[model samples]
Target: MNNKEPWLAVNLSMLFPGFGQLYSGKALKGYILITIEAALIVSTVALWVQGSLGGFLTGFGGSILLVWNLFDAHSSSRSGNEDSFETSRKAGKDAWLGIFLTRILPGLGHFYMGQAVRGCAVLVLYIAMNYALVLLSGSVAGAILGLAASIAYLAAACCLLYITEKNPLRYPLLHIKYFIAGMSIVTIITFSGALLVRTYIIQAYTLPTGSMEDTLLTGDHFIMEKLSYNNVDSTDPGRGIGHGDIIVFTPPGTPVQEHVKRCIAVPGDIVSIKNGEVFLNGAKLEEPYAKGETTYSGIEAGRIEGTVPQGKIVVLGDNRRNSLDSRGFGYVPVENVTGRVILLYWNTRQILKMDFSRIGKVR
Candidate 1:
């Protein structure tokens, strides 16, 4: 078989991460590329869980590998010095199958390409990362692992599939019609499932402003539980919004933007800020999360009525110096409350200031 198409190798590598190198018969290089990328990906995620700023810096290695793979694959394919691997392609494997298979399971595509040991190791690592995340921090950590796991699979698939064209298969490449139909189904299912989950169960929100700084920095993203707070009336119990709860809400006048803050006082509760100290119901509220100090001057500074107004909740920012909350906008109406923030979830900042340690629970 005249399977020496440099462009095919390039295209395959372009589709996956290390396929081009494998196609060029550089099996060791291909394996190294995939392994490094997978390791860096999981490492960055671990850094994130540990809340280190180094995650972003470490994650940059994957990009370097991407460029290196493309360049090396082209060079190897053009030269006659390629080391050939005699592995046969398993039946019915191609780029598309590799993509979805790797995307969903992280290493199944490698198994399909006759790299059983490599495939098993990657699969185990990916699954273990997610499982450990779930055990350490529940589903949100698992979700983060899901997002980060792409790097692992992309690199593995590319390396494995680069050699796929050489082997006998039921269908080495997906026909155009099947590819289109398969992609369409995947798109529809993913979109619909995500939409439904976000609408009824949970949704992610990013803090655009630094109002909730230190605790929730600007650009920090969080997961809000909607089942408990969505369209909830004022007098609701059980899933009730209470003091110390972080909530997403639209201040009375701003219908276009949303703000998140800690509920300092609920209906019929008193709140006062004295020189950076918050007094709740006559006792100074305990707040270790408060950034430095609070001031007494805004609409929130003075003595409130003996109780918070009915159907309203008093909210304050953890970073009181910068936050515009119930102090500035008055009490947040029950209807304006969007969702209760259940998790710190995700945080993204500029490369210089990026921190992942802040990703976790809010309470």
Candidate 2:
């Protein structure tokens, strides 16, 4: 505490990964921490490219670095056996502010208290939990599980902030302006990111009609993959639209709502219907997903024949006889295709809509 400048080391380390140790004359330790931090940054980017779950690694690595630097800064700033820092020793940081900040954003208080790595880790876990909650949106078991996971995350985050702030090297986190700015920035980022992800990457929807029946029930909820047909990103690895794929698209005349149906015939293909059986390219199509023998006879009992026009495709409901689909509405334009239905996701029992099950995948 004899004025070796603990604040300088702490602040520098806070700014980067290992600046505190470097300033405190711990060159080797500083280099190691900085190297690890850099590696983690690279790893995080790679993980994001890999898949959704892998994206969590970046935050995980950053959090670890925060804790290491906090400890390093504290130990290095001490005058050691030389008695130089004896008089410069200071009091611990405010605990109440720690609680308030952590509660607001889970790990932000840790970041403010110089535990950057730990804070980042908490942020990652919190985000992952939120993703899980979104996926498990409509079931009672899912709600309970999501709520428990969130509470646990909150508790762990607050505890980390509390511990970091209580340390001997911690400083006051009571600046109103900084707190307000931090909270505002975080809220904006989180909300905007969520919106982008939901709109462009994936969106969830509940089936309002049993038109899809055997393939997708009335109470089923599914996630739509939005990246490919939108032509938003060329590097997107998802496949192009193919026959038999389930798609969520707008009917030719409907602009206010969307229709979900199976892609029965693509452009240039001839589609013909007879006796509840679909024929493609002059061959009777095999529809393993449809409940061919179970549907009622409301379907217009007639023979129809047509070739799908260029830039347009023909779609049909699984319950062929009972659905008002391409047979009634004409061709669906490719431009109207918004997203592909990739997963079944969730559903409830037909008799008792309250009973739920994770249907997982759609036909």
lDDT of each: 0.65, 0.65
Best by TM-score: 2
| RMSD (CA, Å), each prediction | 13.6, 10.5
Instruction: Residues 1-363, candidate 2: write the lDDT tens digits.
Output: 323345445545654567678767788988998898878866754444333334355657688878778667867966442453344243445443454456667777777677789788888988887787767764565556555664565465335434642434333344223433443454455446545665676677788898888778887877777765775444322225688888888887887578898888887788777666778999989998776542225544432357777777877888765676676777787878878787664665642555434344566
Q: Write the per-residue lDDT of candidate 1 for residues 1-363, one digit (tens) a residue.
A: 334445445555654466667867888888887788778877865554344556557767777777677767767766763234212222245554554456557777777667778778988998787677556442455555644554454465455546566543322444233433443454455446665666566677778888777777787777776666655564563237877888888889999577889888887777776666878899999988788687745454453435677777888888887878776777778778877776665664543467545556565
| Each model's backbone clash number | 7, 9
